[model samples]
Target: MQDRMTPAERLAAVLMGQKPDRVPVNPFILGFAAKIVNLPIGDLYADPRKSFRAQLLCAEMYGYDATPMYAYASFGAWEFGGEVGMPYEPGQSAPYIIRHPVESPEDVDKLEVPDPRKAGSIPIAMEIAKLCYENKMPVVFQAGEVLTTAANIAEPARLLRWMIRAPDVVHKLNKKVAEFFIAVAEYFTSTFGADKCMAFTGGPVESNKLINPRQFGEFVFPYMKQIHSKVLGMGVHVILEHPCSDQNANLPYYVQLRKELGWNGKYIWAFGPETPLEKQIECFGEHDIIMGNVDPPSFQFKSFEDVLALCKDNIERGIKNPSGYILGVGCELPPLAPPINVYALMKAAREYGRYQ
Candidate 1:
């Protein structure tokens, strides 16, 4: 462990299968910090300065290695002129989905990929990335994955119905969505440069707990593979896939996909609490970094001591293999999670996280 190293260097070292000063800590910021600072979510999405300030706050306050510039809600569909209705509670957090477009197979043909630089929330994201680059802060920009975007466009429930009732149409829609995702990535890379931004972060929410692995392979994997290959080709450092469920069964397939695409294991296969760590280690190997198994609910509701103990145990387990692990919540840290617990988790990673 080097005594003096910059956050970006530490992160880059870890991703390159090398030991850093300590395990890099990355926490997902879900635009709540903007609200905390009395900035509306919409405004945060619209103004790069506001978003950058909020991200800097999270990094400075929480000691996070990277600042995630995530959009307020899902934006992939919105680019295609599809309507998305997000319901927010007054005092409580947790976004509720109220509406989406793409009701029938005919709807797929109507979809046209929008210019990411000019469309929906993407311009705002690009601006924020530019600001982060100017400030020399490592930024992790979130681009919705193909399958996740497809699900977003055709509301989850409606897509599920289509999977069962109209499989062919579902495949066509997914392909169209995947193509759009590739275009978006190309546009972002062209604007921000592949090295300036961290890998794309978004969920493949259509998998496992929501649908089986067969459906995942059919609707999710192909598109994800396309996006992953493109990003890898551009020499991107990481492509963190967020699938917040027990995706152990899909591990082998993910590994195979990486092999087929000739991807370095630096990219993350971020999993939920239900994923077995031992199995992930065995399947993905010692050099492949894994992120998150800590359940967000536990950290939010449990005692700090309990959270510390869990984090300590996880760090110990991770170092058993060495240099290829990160400690983070399975999903975004709940907005209400105790700041002390978050600090404790980071502290545990610093003290107990080591490569030998």
Candidate 2:
């Protein structure tokens, strides 16, 4: 029960389904903290040192179980001229098109995979990984899943349309994207030790609310399995399949996939406020780690009391499996979330996250 557990010890304990001294909190810091600390968001995708300093500072100030030095945007499509727009605010993560470049079946044959080491923002991300590793902080490297990457390349709306209009093209594109991401994962893991690398799949590919079980099986599941298998083959722990919508209906599919792929339930299936904790815990059971559910809006617009209440509710939902839970905002923390509210989340985690 030592408070000074090594990062490896803490993470290994969690992955092994054992209680550590307390639950781990691994929230991605953005918005106000970046500005208050004077870390510019624009530099995050371009400068590894700036990103590393900001992330390390947040980890030091807030006390997280792990440090994740993530590029603010996906490197592949961004480098290939994938319709990305400026941030909603001056110091926020840049927003990309709901649509993509590979709009038609013909576009699939023309899509080129960007090399991770040479791509637009990937070198910076890799450099950040080196920085985090040099600092001796465990780093989780976030990457987009095949579907997300495909969506990024062809735009989400176009890809969704292609699912029904041109399923074969969608399948081909996803396979290519999956393979590309695997290479990226391999490069980073090899460069910065597998133990320090955690692969992140962004967006809601597994959500039944967004895509049906049939669609997921055809378009999403295979690519996810490929990505997860590739990462595991490289001896890296693939942490979160960040599906923000309702995954209850497809939880069985994920559970079955994990069994087939030999993934221990220790891998995370992160959710947001939209995913009720009762449903998530009931569907996935005690072995699974639930990473999110605290509404970002509360942190952005609500009172500290309200934020505390949200934290308490999320924690209470996983009280029976404290070691299998992480305290975090439903998605990226809003750029304007109050520092006190952020601290409130950490305090609640400390108070309620104790392993009895």
Candidate 3:
């Protein structure tokens, strides 16, 4: 699509609270981008060459306003002693966690902050960051956040148990996890620029659905706040990914997080389809960036028409915000998401998402 600004320029303008030609659309296609080129998703991840090319190809195919880097799942865990073993299969878009590093509460104490430069996927991810900078692809990466990384490194059950029975142990582990991601945030901001880098986490982050506000206050808040302060200080933007559903119950905590963090709303917060459109619009629409919320997994079952209709509904709801919005699937697209459905998404975005 022709634009008054380059994709990078449009992203920058919108982020600075200026109008771009239209709202940005960056679905989290990740390894699914490889499928469009018929490469095994495994190689696309492990091999930098394939991963880079596939990411660019997918952006071109979909005409996304910005591209995404897959600093995906377990890269931090593997570096900090988790066993990462899902070899990408032809049909598989992502590797799975064969083994996690920490099995018990005590294991969390043994965790060390790996050197960000030498850590698990940091080298590959660094290479990806370099490529993006050189090519000027406006992009974002998902490194592990403190709370999620704690769960990743240690079993969630064990981590949560410690949060209740032994809160000190949980804090100790979170400190290490926060340190690792803070280094990662610094790396990206230093390599590229703050405007070009976004640090994202929170599929299960302190969601009221998973834990109570008191638990959030006790266990999750401090570490996450530390991580947020450090990363934002390093000049990178931070995104607290889908803080949890049941906004009535959980949204206010997120609201408090933004205000307390003094974001005055520079930070971005994403929400999933499970979150109500009105609530997101009311809470985040005017104050902060909201990237999000089309469901990727449901694409396969729905017809192209249905998917487009849903995208129409989703975009219409999202664009009401003055803070700016990016249309996207909240997380990675399912591996087998149909090409037609993917096309429908891009088409729907362009047709329905144009600015007035």
Q: Summarize candidate 1's per-residue lDDT along 1-356 as a digit string, tens digits.
A: 23356677777787777887777776555554665566665545556787688767767776667664755436566666665443334553433334566777888777666666676666767778777778775445565566667777787777788889988877888777766666666776776677765666556465566778777787777777877787667756667777666676666667777788765636675777777677777766555677746777776789989998888887776655443777777776776676677777777777777544
Per-residue lDDT tens digits of candidate 3, residues 1-356? Answer: 45455677777876788877777777777777777887777866677767888878887877776564756654445778666754565455566666788876667666677887887667777777778778876446554456667776776777777787888888888788777777777777877877677776664645656678787766666666776777677666546465534334667766766777786437566666678667877876767877768876677688899989988888898877788877877666776788888887778777887886
RMSD of each: 2.7, 2.9, 2.4
Q: Which residue ranges in model 3 land beyond 4 Å of their true spot?
A: 1-5, 139-143, 193-195, 237-248
* Regions of model 2 farther than 4 Å from truth: 1-12, 71-76, 79-92, 95-100, 205-209
For candidate 1, the clash count comes to 0
Whole-model lDDT per candidate: 0.68, 0.69, 0.71
Highest-scoring model, lDDT = 3
Candidates 2 and 3 compared by lDDT, better number: 3
- Model 3 residue 347 CA deviation in Å: 1.6
Clashing pairs for predicted structure model 3, backbone only: none
Instruction: Name the lDDT value of residue 326 in candidate 1.
Output: 73
- TM-score of structure candidate 3: 0.91
lDDT for 109 in candidate 2 is: 86
**Mind sharing the TM-score for model 1?**
0.89
